[model samples]
Target: MTDTPENGAAAPTAAPQITSRVLAQYIRDMSFENILAQKGVTGDAQPEIQVQVNLDARKRSTDNQYEVITKLNITSKTKEKGDPLFVLEIEYAGVFHVEGVPEDQMHPYLLIECPRITFPFLRRIVSDVTRDGGFPPLNLETIDFLALYRSELARRAESEKAKAN
Candidate 1:
């Protein structure tokens, strides 16, 4: 039953509340190779690091459940000699139970928001792996998911435009 105002007009229905929960998070795969150690390079080496990130999302068999994966590839090379230092690759995934997000916004929510929730853990793992692999801990700067998403969209638009021409 809807509550009516004193004038007896019907009240508008309220919108459904948005809800989301992370069901599980895990490192689906990871690998770290210390190339400097294998090469027997022992002097003080300044490192230049490059990091690449990619995201993916897919629906689960269970209703209202989705899995999002963040893939990272990181490489470090010596600044002076351009020698390989190390390479780290990881795929991290989160399972989320979500409700009330409009379909149009669901893609962004899964790709942007879910990865935001899981990134800190992924960063910590990177730092730990680098330190354990015989280099100083490599702390990653925070990622701007919104900017990344926007750039990806722009790239796709450019690709489509090129194809049409």
Candidate 2:
């Protein structure tokens, strides 16, 4: 302000501003292991599968950017010898610029839209891996991220309601 501009007026100072808004996506790792059950059911085998998906959400040093990672583990096999039929691991991430978004609206954006945007590619990769593994192509069940998020919210609300009741 160099002596307050010599007129009893304060000099203008620079205010901090938001720097960057970017969405970066990458595939960290993926693996498909098919261990065909040996000397066990092959024909007429009603293969049983166990599907598990895990999500990890994180915010970096920046206030506006967030990362949502989804990991899938699929194990499909018969019930005869406890053998592993197919195991798939997919680790994928989506980064988003969430600045200016209300705090109340953050959960849905991360849990639903981010994952929905990342799922089709993940699904395609899984299908390709399974098909190339000399087994029937595995078509993953459709994921309803919005529905899942809503269900979670509803469950929480119900629990609170029950507690109050």
Which predicted model would earn the best lDDT?
1
Question: What digit string (tens of lDDT, one per residue) describes model 2 on residues 17-59?
Answer: 4332437877888887767734444555556878787777788
Clash counts for all predictions: 0, 0
Please provide, for model 1 over 78-130, each residue's C-alpha lDDT reduced to its tens digit, 9 standing for 90 to 100: 88878889999999999999999999999999989999999999999999999
Q: What is the TM-score of each candidate against the true structure?
A: 0.90, 0.68
Worst 10 residues of 1 by lDDT: 36-45
Task: Estimate candidate 2's alpha-carbon lDDT, on a 0 to 1 scale.
Answer: 0.76
| C-alpha positional error of residue 129 in candidate 2 after TM-score superposition, expressed in Å | 1.2
- Report clash pairs, candidate 1: none
**Alpha carbon lDDT of each predicted model:** 0.93, 0.76
